[model samples]
Target: MALDTLDLGVLAAIVLAIVIYFTKGSLWGKSDGEDVSVPRGSSRDLVEILAANNKKALVLFASQTGTAEDYSHKFAKEFQSRFSIPTMCGDLADYDYENLNEIFTSIDGFQLVVFFTATYGEGEPPDNAVEFFDYLENECDDLSNLKFSCFGLGNSTYEFYNAMGKKTVSTLTEKGATLVGELGLGDDGRGTMDEDYMAWKDGLFDILKDQLSLEEHELVYEPQIKIEESVLTIDSPEVSLGEPDDKYINPSQEEAQSLNEGPFDHTHPYLAPITVSRELFNSDSRHCIHAEFDISDSNLKYTTGDHLAIWPSNSNEHVFKFLDILGLSEKKDVVIDIKSLDPTVHPHVISPSTYEAVVRHYLEISGPVSRQFVGSVAQFAPTEQAKAHASKLGKDKALFHEEVTSRYLNIADLLHVLSDGVKWTSIPFAFIIESVAHLQPRYYSISSSSLSEKQAIHVTAVVEQEKYPNVDHIVTGVATNLLFNIQLAQNKVSNVKPVVTYDLAGPRQKFAPFKLPVHVRRSTFKLPSNPATPIICIGPGTGVAPFRGFIRERVAQTANDISVGKTLLFFGCRNSSEDFLYKDEFVDYSKKLGEKFELVTAFSRETAEKVYVQHKMLERAKEISELLNDGAFFYVCGDAARMARDVQNVLIRIMMSERKVTESIATDMVKNLRVLNRYQEDVW
Candidate 1:
């Protein structure tokens, strides 16, 4: 059969089309019939989105760990429901701010823009909000017609407390945007962030009502998402039974092997194996863990002072308790599909997932109950008496604090008490999905030098367990307990019962025995690049994690025939014999480094006066001042609430005494050192 020129051309085009289809158009620029101009999700323009959706209010969040985003969603929901205004909540990263002024002109009537921003480390904007902040600072000039409000979530322990929120409000006001209410600041350091937010929100609502002449209606439960029971079972390949994403849900063997491949990030984590796990402290009452992760095959990289984020699932105890309280115990394994009721809203959790899997892997059901959330759920209480009690707990802040906050009662615990053995069956599943915050990864300081153990990351953690005076239940740390149980499993220890049981064998046993979903987060806390630079470290307890890495890094440099400088470490613990961490290792380090390495120990319990690291620092004030004059770097990593503050004050006092400077001048000198990057802190 002889083929003509036209026939051959057509055949060649058909073959190319098949190749493009199989490769998803990667082999070529684009598929022949593909429309590349179609929008993937939503319009990035603020004006276009607001006008298209006919939204009167837009709530945006710049969040690092999702706290600000959660608060924004709560605010948006409340504002819309109470004032009968159409509101849209979105991430700052998803929007284009060049048309900020257009939103004011395009949207008719009283349009509002609300910002819920969190100040990241060192007063930096969150990664998602960087672009928006850049636009606000550089491009935005006139927003005279715009009206906005801002609420900042911050830890006062940090020097630049609420910097982002304050900056945003200030910038907006400078651009002539009228503020709807006073700038709100929530202090996480004081553990009054929730209370602060609620108070600010109440006041903001009052202002909004007056400004818009809005008549508030009775608050009722409204579901932002719709959940339907699907016919699929938990065993179905289409259902995600604790899988992170579609790639892990019944993946092929080839895909499974490559699951830990590169580009690991917040959205995707590498399942790294735990190569080493052991107890650090000798005390029987207090436990501190030292675990190492094998990232050789995973290709996950880290530096000496970086952070390792560990993704953890809720314990079976908490998961089951949550299900039992919600009356979903019988239907734990029933698959359900979730859909967002509003066009602007998106489902946070993956579907079709079982109730147990959602509760275990997605939602944060074990945290302290929010007072506002308690009030919202009071209407759904089973009995009138329960409703009254719930309402009182929600309204009376002092009483609520005494009953719930002081005792550390989680949502499940509170519900169990309110129900008095009855299940909250009337509450909608969608409401639960909307109200509860999503589970976030826990971060730990990487306590290993990348130069020495390039393929491994180390974590030192103190197992947190608190028992309040009158509370029958003990509050336990989630991630630490998970690690402890994993350590117990890996060590083949049979005598000790598990503190909290987790699904160690992750979805389909992918993370069997001892493996964790982890990723590295780059940190600014780092040792000076020059090896000869002198360093002074103050770290108490597990705060010594990064300092260990720094010392190891110097040791590695010296092994390579590099000249190392004076290394001074001030470490504090309860008793030298009982809770002293890495005692033998420090001794070995002292031997290796000789006169260059010095370890100053402060055994608080051993001394009746309760001498701490600050006391030790004061004793060697002259040497510390001499080191400062010699351009030595100062580092502190410990409790931000007390220890970090104390260390800083002591440093200032030492400068005042040794340098013959005033107290104010010494304080300014420390501040200058921080600005020059000569002083660094990794507190809290």
Candidate 2:
């Protein structure tokens, strides 16, 4: 899922995590030529624009990444197009809450005010929405006349599901705003965000017709943007071609200057050298990489439990497929500029570059295609049969799921299937840019303790590969495969070419010598402040990354003669010899800590029946309950969907059986532990 609209402001500090319970990758490229100039409407405030345009509807978005912003824009566009309601999309950061009460009086009352917000980490609003959130919480009052509706984007896996959206609706109601419809919550964890959004909009529209006298107009395909060929040639140095920043456009002059630059962030990542690279798992087929990055010269610092974000480029194979399907492969080097014809519609990818850059660096051409996006492209289909198929697939939910989503078919793949190798030249490149999500950076938990290696950060990533049933090609995780390629290159490993290869040299060899652009991200998942605090960790497969750091820190502390409490780690894998990561290291640590450090293993393949971490936790129910009572900081890191939930259930069962508490009481106890920071999770 993409970040909220607020991501533009706070994206740098934010980490795009890929918690490999043996899993994932994403991107956010910042070419030096990337748009830095202020947007056109910067001078005029939201209220002023609303009044000037006579816009009755205002959709305010507080997006952590860009998903909320995208939804807000879509809503604004739909409202304007369908009901002829002048709607304007506004970022929460761009408006002042002090004058929010004037919306009713200043513009003869707003017909509608919609909020599209995403709840970020720990139930907090995105950084850009923080001021607005604060203002609503403390200062804002008396919105009795203001009519509104809300749609919240959230992952159900997180404890604070839809917190931001729920709080917004609550606060608005408290201030006496008339809620037009039920507060909509889109759960990304369940992959029902689109369905939830569509359903909510239906309810919202019905209410709008009765309240605001809105009448639906004929829905037609509207082009939100214009595309044109630029005079700039492919050989032009100014053209962006997957370059990180403008510094890379002319590296000779900027390289030295960049070296002396003070700050390096998401826009400008420090190219850290890999000091060591090796396979964690013993198996050849299923491999996990353990790599240590040298951040000594990057002026980057991180404590234990922090994350390291890696910005990755799209695979050439995927890029080529996208370009080829679009019939832009031959003219990929031809420069083009994309401009938004509608002010409400913004082009996600900055233009005035070759088609290659747009396909390779900007667009998310690898992910599953959205039905809405496919529907939009249907009108541009080359053949009548293709057009009919596309329309049916888009309109029919079941057909779409069966033919597209279930098949793991991306835009290019779907197009190929529909046209049978025919290129979609009729489709506008501008629309492609508008439809696709921006490439986001992938993050991994720093597996090395800062105390053990202050100047270095280690990451353990399992190369994700899964064969889709009935599909000819295997599904490969983008970032993990890239890392695997890098690992293979670094260790000089032979055979088994990875699914995709990367341009390791990185824009004129700027990132040579095994360098990866990365930055540190702070996390709440931390060990107890006291060294003597007992910790129970349940991490199966590559989820052991952070736990490795935790144990290493303790090992170093123990070596320094510091007293450490019992650290019981419940780890699971397919087999002990196959995918057991850091096995030798854990053995060595146990020898140092004696019974203070206990390593519990669950190898499913080793036995006739499958065993997992949850089973192990339940088996040691009494010991686990006793440790919890003794104030042990219980930690679980792995797959959020299944593993985390299962482990939590196991812990609750332990509490119920051993502590002789009811199920509800046990659940509350677990919740309380989370509230007290005694139950920490670093799941994906």
Candidate 3:
């Protein structure tokens, strides 16, 4: 209190230093302060990016799953090496719109090509890229001199093929970004996507070559990582398995229900009691299972949208063969370190965990192989015989289809056939893991109402059977097989149990083996909060899964003071008499919920000309228009990529014809429906 001015001055100086040090950022960053120069595409980080002789080109990919990302990374590497154009892979979220605008506002001759795969990965971006893309889409940008190209990967089977790509290209063009090549699209369902991309690549490169206006050196293979034998081994990568992340990894259930937590997961799977499994169709050739898992534990609770991840083991038949070829079944403890020349690639071509794990849960060595895989590993062939055989198999689709897919054989089986039981390549285990999608859960549309059977989850799926040109028949769907086993246990038909004697249980006893690992997903696709809002459901065949739950909910609830919306369902099948599934159940439900439900059936094979759900909607255009005018919501649950699109088209036309609305008007209504969450389709 009595301090002199000098002492006070020193204290103030110290305080000022601390304030200036911490608050300096705000002082210069003030909106009204002196203007600071900002780069277009380059952010503050790019400002400090040390200049090099090679120019930088930003490559951005809008990927759902990892497909677009994989391809984008591959191309980026090629661009870096061949043209010597230093490349940086950018996510849409990382840079600001203004930063990108700055990068393109001037005569910077660099390019920004976007690889987009339309459709949601977990409803948008592969759980990793959604926020970034959303930011770019929302933020306005100025790209006067920027040149870009778009390559979209989609499934023609789905209605919204390359939708994101189409929307993206339109928006960027609006912002004045010049396009370098024709917008590219790849379709996966048709299986022509890869070659289609290859076809487009030539034309794409021609345009890129012109726009880039740069010389091309010889394109040579340069892997990003160095592959060596057992030289660089680390602790096996730890898999988080289940346990939800930020996005609520639990199932999408309409109501709370018990869930099984353990005795099942990526690492340890619950050999849940399979109560029921049966053939959905009477086709001996096809394999489909209708299974119900006993979820008696609160920890195993699931919502409707959650997927049940099943840890699958290679069939013992295939496992034994793999062991024979690798000649390592007896050497269980001999651990191997894998290092691929390409770090992007996995080091272990097999299982990184253990032999017991491989046979029990890892990918089988024997199965259908891709042309890409054959072409990729061809260089590693040990002999001329191996090279020729591999090259032939890679190019010959017929051969691959007949020998691999038809038999449902894995790598080990094929090698046995190819090498006549010779020693298999000492391929690393990690490669197999990287090549295959982690054993994803086989999702079933809950076929029953949660109210009636809170713990029971039901799914309807047709078995798959394909016989290639003069080849053995093959049947598979790892989880489906388990479903079949569940039916057996439920019926007590055979003493066979779904649970196997595996390491997960550590040889302990259980209720006869085989546990189903499942989780629930919460769904926004439930009945409207106001049940009075009418709904039009169009689903073909098994697409009717979710609709079942929707109807069940309406029936189970009391109607004392409710405006139960009229429900119109359009279901299609091959033959009405034999394949009209849940026919009796629908009739019973309709009788009880009269005026609240309407069932429409279309059979594609009933007549020579095939009729689908879309045709039904068009035929009832007048009625549909009236329903829409009454504010009815549209639900297309079956095929989002195709049938959904087709139904949407019919809806738009109906609006145009009956409502006397323009096509643009109809489109606006559709977009509004989307924003309002009215036009919802759960197609896969």
Candidate 4:
């Protein structure tokens, strides 16, 4: 119950999951619960469940937001096809772990594959995988015959980077499971994660040969399903998309009852109508917009700490670059049919959609192209000369990264430089789908309370549009620009505005037919269950999103019953006069809450030097410590890499200096916030 890896049944489940992960595709898709929820006495089936010779490769995903699940499916697809391994995918919660050793002892002829697994929230395994990890660490069993490999994905910025994967691998090895290779570490801290993986893949292959005495086989690109006369589409057309129709928007009684889970997700999306939009910038630096999407038809619900994913398309300019480089801008056979031998995360490229859709929607071709992507498809050149050229470019990373990614060149642009209009056949369709995070929604923190606005959500997004240090004319964010443009469009259409000029047939037609698809995700960061809890908040710039909602809820509660605790907000900005957002509104909140509310402002650019939110926290350390001692809930919402961590350090110092406690004890005092549910962070 305390989340230690000590249960016998839990240990059994972890072994089974590690062993049977690759078989997710072969068994589960048959609509059989038979292969799932490992039964109490099925020891033999559990072992066979992991063996790949005749069984499915289990793909057990420990995911926070489905990214791991998606990547695991893609790996499962390639693993099954490349090695003739069958895959079975499952969520960690599916198995009860009541009998895990049966799984541990039976992994002799099996292959174990893990993807993007690690725990958040103080190194506890992801919410769903908690029990499994605990069981594996605490349980006892031998798995010497086990053949396994691991791919650990985590950001290096965290304290316990990939600790879950590292701990699991060590625990399994201690129990006699023979690991097939060196652990694969995928660090997103630096931008070179993809490159780092390519190196890891090569080393993993070498280790696999030495451990299994396996000979290298020609890994041909084979799809699970064969397409005959199939169009060049990547995904199924009938799957579901497009704006809601008249029948789709407002549902009948029965339909409403059936709409508990929204059709909109990473795989499928509901394109809602835009109800409002507006631009927030006056100069050419960048644009920020406030826009809302109507989701009445879908059952998507969200709390204040959630994020929204938006799907966007490549600008026509980038599309042309891809077309020109591939020399397919004029060809008619530029179609693709994707097939997976295993269950794919969501075969992002399997479209009846067309080659254009694959390039524009399925792939991030317009963004920076890693040298590994270029190397992977290099042999598929249309001509021998081009193949040689591509090979050289791949080996010479400096030249490639500089001329291509640095120049903002896409895949198509690179292909054109290597080839002279010839065609090659060695490239695989699986690489594109397997290589990336899906082109889905980018999340923004909710700036409004659902209690106050009910159906409406507010997000204060700052557009990131600027040129890089070396690159010219670069765009900052895809979703931000999309939102900003939508805002401008709405303002022009409104009859109340006076000084507005927006041409429907002007230069912004690349996003000509723009509609938004949105979905919500839940978060555990919530307000205190009791309204009488005192709160201390620090929100600098747009980081103020959640604090606004927190204050609103408190203000509303006070208005209703006249019972509440003190509220203090530490707000920071560049200038008090130029762009101090929510300055006027703080006065209103203070008046409503009377002496119970306080607002502290810090202007980073008030003078030649700059000051930020963390400085303000130190300035009020005495008050902050006193409030914490009085059981006040503290919330931090801002940049995760620096500001959040800096503020944390400041809080620790306050506890140390003012309370006269040793560093270690002060650290625990801060950690106690998480344990007592008094401290929370919504930083990404």
Instruction: Give the best candidate by lDDT.
Output: 1
Ranking by TM-score: 1, 2, 4, 3
Order of candidates by lDDT, top first?
1, 2, 4, 3
Which residue pairs in candidate 1 have backbone atoms (N, alpha carbon, C) closer than 3 angstroms, thus clashing?
A: none
Which scores greater on lDDT, model 1 or model 2? 1
Q: How close is candidate 3 to the true structure, as a TM-score?
A: 0.68
Q: What's model 2's overall lDDT? A: 0.80
TM-score of each: 0.93, 0.88, 0.68, 0.77
**CA lDDT, every prediction?**
0.87, 0.80, 0.58, 0.61
Off by over 4 Å in 1: 1-40, 252-258
> Looking at candidate 1, what is the lDDT of residue 111?
62
> Per-residue CA lDDT of candidate 2, range 1-684, in tens?
887868854764444333221122103322222231333355435556667556788999998656787788777777877887777787787766766766767896467889998987667797569898888888887888778899999989887899999999999899988888899999999998887888898789988888777888865556566677878886676666666555556457657556535366555667789889888877657878888999887678888988888877777889898899989989988888666654444565655677887777666678778787777688889888888899898788899998988888888899999988888999877667766777766779889999888889999998887777887777777778778888899888887778777767765566677887776767889999999999999999888999999999999899999999999999999998889889899989999889999999999999899999999998899999898888999998878778988888888899999989999999999999989999988877
Clashes of each: 0, 15, 80, 44
TM-score of 4: 0.77
For model 4, how does the per-residue alpha-carbon lDDT over 1-684 read when each residue is reduced to its tens digit? 566656767988997787566554434442112333332223334344444324434656676655556556556655555556565555665555433444444554445544347555445577668777777766656545444566666666665677876876787688776666677777766655555665666686566566655456555444443322343222342321111222233357885455435555555555555666655333345444556665555566666666666666555556556655554466423444444433222354543334555555555655556665565466567777887777776778678767776676556566766775453434444454565445555677776676665666666677665677776556445556556656656565453321212222211132244456566656666777777878898888777877877777778877788587888888887777655666677889998889888988888888777888788888888989988888899988877667777887888899998899998999999988978978887776
lDDT of 3 by residue, 1-684 (tens): 798999999999999888778764446442212122431234524312212212367667665434676566556666666677766554454444455555543325555544544445213444335565565578766666666777777766664566676766777788887777878888776766656665566577776678667668765445433322332222323211222221112235632122334433433344455555555554334434555666655455555423444434444445566666656567433434233332112322232234434344444343455555565445555566876787787677678666655566666666666666666555444444444333334445666666545776666665433455555534344545545544554465664433222222211122245455455544556667777888888888878877877777677654444557888999998876666767778998898689889988899998999988888888888888778778888887765556777787888888788878899998788778877878887777
In terms of lDDT, model 1 sits at 0.87
Q: Name the candidate that leads on TM-score.
A: 1
Ranking 2 against 4 by lDDT, winner: 2
